[model samples]
Target: MAEESTKSWADTDSESSSSSSSSSDSEQEEVHYLIDDQTSDDEVFDFSNIEFTREDLVQALNDMVHEYKTLSHTFEEIKAENASLKNSSAKSSSDELEDTDSLKIELSKLRIENELLRSESSELKAEVEKLTK
Candidate 1:
């Protein structure tokens, strides 16, 4: 049975060109077909049932392109703002470091002056003690 089925399939494909020619001749013979229980002599194959037009699709794509452009501009603006803030922060931190360095130098000068005053006071005390004796 399987062999018979295979043989039938093989025979069907053996003369494909002849089969196609016969089918074409039969199509030219003119047969009747039905549609929705009504006979349609003319095959009115319409393609207007689709919703979107070329113009509608083009308009939608243009709108999406405009939105993408606006988003890119906004992203650039945010990035510029972030960069400016970072630069300002770095400048302010450097300024603070300079101020701290100046304060440290002033403190060092004051300490030297304090040591000189202590040495002068000790010399004056020794002179007063010699005068008392």
Candidate 2:
């Protein structure tokens, strides 16, 4: 069974290589397939025959580096924005506290003024009674 499986794999590999060599990139793309995690072990194919030249590898590495740098820059920007938002939130909370303190001070002053007005009114009423008597 193992020998038969190996022979079948070899036969398929040879056919693929021959056809790929004769076809263009688009045609090769059509012939290739994607397998999922659920694929059986026997269904999985190795990419041993695929070869990358030095230029191809270098270009791929450079592209990956550029992508990494871009993502890192974006992450830093988001971190900075988050920090700025936190600072603004803290500042707003402080400002609200200051406003509440000021309002309390003003209310105390108004209460004192109200008491003084009441006392003056009482004094005026007593004088009016004396004058009437």
The number of the candidate with the highest lDDT is: 2
- Candidate 2 clash pair list: none
The digit string of per-residue lDDT tens for model 1 on 25-129 reads 665444322233343454333123266344454555567779999999999999999999999999999999999999999999999999999999999999999
The C-alpha stretches of model 2 lying farther than 4 A from their native spots are: 1-58
Candidate 1 structure, TM-score to reference: 0.53
User: What is the per-residue lDDT of model 2 for residues 1-133, given as tens digits with 9 covering 90 to 100?
Assistant: 3455556667966787776554656655554543233356654234223663434445555677799999999999999999999999999999999999999999999999999999999999999999999
Candidate 1 residue-wise lDDT at 63: 78
Q: How does candidate 2 fare on TM-score? A: 0.55
lDDT of 1 at 49: 29
lDDT of each: 0.70, 0.73
**Which candidate number would show the highest TM-score if scored against the true structure?**
2
**Every model's TM-score:** 0.53, 0.55
Point out the worst 10-residue segment of candidate 2 by lDDT.
44-53
Q: Backbone collision count in every prediction?
A: 0, 0
Candidate 2, residue 122: how far the Cα is off, in Å: 2.3
